[model samples]
Target: MIFRLSPKSRRNLSRIIPYGVIWLFLGWFILTLEFLATGNENQRPETEITLSFGVLVFASLAVFIAGLLMGVLEVFVFKNLFRSKGLGAKIALKMGIYLLFMLILNALTFPLAASLELGTTLTDEKVWEKFWRYLGSVTFWSTLISLSFHILLSLIYSGFSDHLGHGVLLNLFTGRYHRPLGESRIFMFLDMQSSTSLAEKLGHQRYFDFLSSYYNELSDAIVEHEGSVYQYIGDEIVITWETEKGLRNGQCVACFFAMRKQLESKARYFQEVYGVIPAFRAGLHCGQVTTGEIGALKKEIFFTGDVLNVTSRIQKLCKIYGKELITTQVLKDQLPQAMADQAQSLGDLELEGRAEKIELFSLA
Candidate 1:
């Protein structure tokens, strides 16, 4: 009987077919050797070999079909069912469960096949005796080992071959796929000011080298502050932390400033390498954003909303106000008394496309 298969199922079957053929050939070769050594030359050698080959082929086909069915069930039915857990955990769990299922199937088939009888005593004994005995003995152990090996190999291959495919599948099946659900938050955009002008003065190769070191220093600092890097635009780095984390504790913001200080020392190395030192300007603002994967083929987590736009505008305002860092009143309101004293108020300034002028401040 023909069963309709999904595209995914067809793909999985295609992968299984080649492996099944190889195992079938191996099983036939091993069983053929046993038949030749045991069966007498006067007792019709061809008939004995054919019977042995049929049993081996049937057993091999049974194992292959069981694995193929389990793989199909996993890809189609189970994958969407568990879609709440993390990807890695889900795949590991599914593989474990699949292995257990195959073991159970083998257990059931062994006894049932052994109990079945053919017409005469010789035919009955010959059909059930060695067939079930072999399956219960070496075949069972071999199948277990081979399956374990396949799982390990598949995981290793998936890590390098298609990590995202595996990741997406895992997330989808385990129900672990979550879009960022946090409140409207503060975002900081830090840029190396006049970077283009500096790059032009320095040669292309030297400028590229300086940028590499510069980005490393910035990334290290952002990570230290527990900020997620949104993206790097030219020589600028955009980083974000939960507003509550940064404004309430102030640790995140403080760590970022400390990172800036560390970069200042690193700037000396850039000066030696490219004959120019880099300066950075930053801006911070608080607002709501939707953060999730965007793009069909090349997916990436991106934050989108007015909050992101305003943060960029505030960074540009750093050049207008002649300050290293700029922050909005929203950020100031959330700051502690002592930290607030360090900020220089820039009063209200009209920003492009805004209905009202915004109150801004600079970090001293």
Candidate 2:
């Protein structure tokens, strides 16, 4: 028998596994320190050593379990609970909620740890007595403090990972783009149709809210297609993908349609809330780009090449040609044959500021 997870599940698991390891190490570190302090190395009895070893094993297992539960709650349960709230409010709310959750977990684990030490059943009176006593002990407070500190660290990491895409953060930490490298990438320049008119109709604040909602809906499709958001400029979003990933099964093309379908599925919600269903246009092109990190105060992974310029020009032509989506022949040729066959040629069109005219295609 075999088991498999969807892309989203795999991403969630990647986040979850780290919490377990962090908590496990914290627990082991605390136990080992106490173990060393409580006894002499040459004079410890055999039974004491055995009991201490049992306590260490059981306590480590307990914290590891607690860590896994915390991961699930953080990833699936508490995520987005106060997504629209300010940072301070979100942090305060999560701290209160997680504090209570951690307390409950600690309470439950206490009796099991006591049972392992005493070699008694969890239901024994001694276990409950020990649990109550442990609650007030310095060790209990220390553990709580340690857990809080770790939680804060995790929150900071999550914030960074969210603001900068996870892939971008990993690359920055690993120094993968410290030196510039040229690579073939697919770029999609997507923009809302009639954004100026929509902004005028909705007003500034309302329009900002609308854009947030719009991007939130499209993000799922982009992630599913393994696209990284390059930038968000006003009502437009730029997405990029490695050539292999984008061309695989025509995922770059599929992502565009998927985003449209996602918005359409929420048509009633958008119409009821904002009095309009947003429409978008996109232009995609693939070619080599110089990729590297740049900046001192604010570092950013940037892609620089003529391909980006060409892609942007093609997207601008969407309004001129009155088309929903357009792509260059250079990219279309690399797509799956079935997808390529679906594209209707739009002839060689001259792009602004470029010497050569490039043949384009429109996906119906």
Candidate 3:
């Protein structure tokens, strides 16, 4: 059977591959060794016989196929069903999906091992008795295995995402940045507006909660616009993307506006919950930056150059210039015509600690 995956689904599928590879190899080794160690290979448990093989080629294929199927199905669940639901609801949904998929797998593989004999050429009473026993065993083991796998996978993905952010883990591990490299990238510095006053109004703990919810609200827009979160510093977030990805559909610009719209829509909700509405100021610029992995104790893929400096300065100018979003002419020049036309001149402006004046623009 052929299954087509959407881009988002493909991304989710890619995340579990490393774990799946290790699981496949480990399962094959343990099962083969255990069967051989039994000393009576002819006599096997039904499930054991199904996965065992006389030839290494067949054994490898069986292990690979089982691993591939389970991995794909579980990832599908993660991508489609695992939304930002409540904990109780998510767990119940996952258990249901696991039980259903496991039964489907058992149906397909039992016959492949020619172990479907339990129901064939047998009296109805005998077949029903065997069927109940088979169902009971499969249900017990499938639940146990699925729960363990889900827990392990969650931990792996969480730890990976927390430290590395999204979409850069494999690249780092593959030595994609062994040496300093130069590449053109779009950078945005998003900072919460009136942060000092807001902090005073809400105090420390409440202010931290506000920042958390504020960033959480922007997470969807970032992913939807296909942007990578470079870093989070205090109350500000830094986002970056390779030139092509950022400019492909003008995500670099559109993302900022999308975030504004999202917050606007949630304005009433925020007011009711936090007793305050949050606003943001952002700056955009594009240029070449030196990129490489930095630090030994706390290793990081770092980007360094004037591009970041310029972007940060522009963000600071938002309040000074009385604009919510600010961008340099350098970035506007690279945007597509449709997006470029949205920019109207804000005139040349001098940035702090910089000798050269920059031509700036604000989007309509």
lDDT of 2 by residue, 1-364 (tens): 8898865677777777767776888767755676598643523221122337776677678778777777788788877888889987887787778778888887877777677777889899977876776676665676678778766666666677778877788788789999999999999999998899999999999999999999999988998887889999999999999999899889999999999999999999999999999989999999999999999999989999999999999999998888899999989898889899999998999999999888999984
Best candidate according to lDDT: 2
For TM-score, candidate 1 versus 3, the one ahead is: 3
Candidate 2 has an lDDT of 0.84
Q: Estimated TM-score per prediction?
A: 0.54, 0.89, 0.73
Q: What is the lDDT of candidate 3?
A: 0.72
Per-residue lDDT of 110-177 in model 3, one digit per residue for the tens?
34344333424334454444444555575437535743564455445544644586467776777887
| Candidate 3 global TM-score | 0.73
- Each candidate structure's count of clashing pairs: 12, 0, 0
Better of 1 and 3 by lDDT: 3
| lDDT, candidate 1, 1-364, per-residue tens | 9987743344456544533444445545655665688552324321122343344445767656665565456444674566566767867876787678767776655443443322234346565555555555655576577666555444343333233443344434344424654367678888887888887887687777778778767755565555656666778877777777667557556756876788788777877777676778888888788765556786555577888888889889989878988888888777887877888889998887788888898874
Candidate 1 stretches with Cα past 4 Å from truth are 1-182
Question: How do all the candidates rank in terms of lDDT, highest first?
Answer: 2, 3, 1
Largest TM-score belongs to which candidate?
2
- What TM-score does candidate 1 reach? 0.54
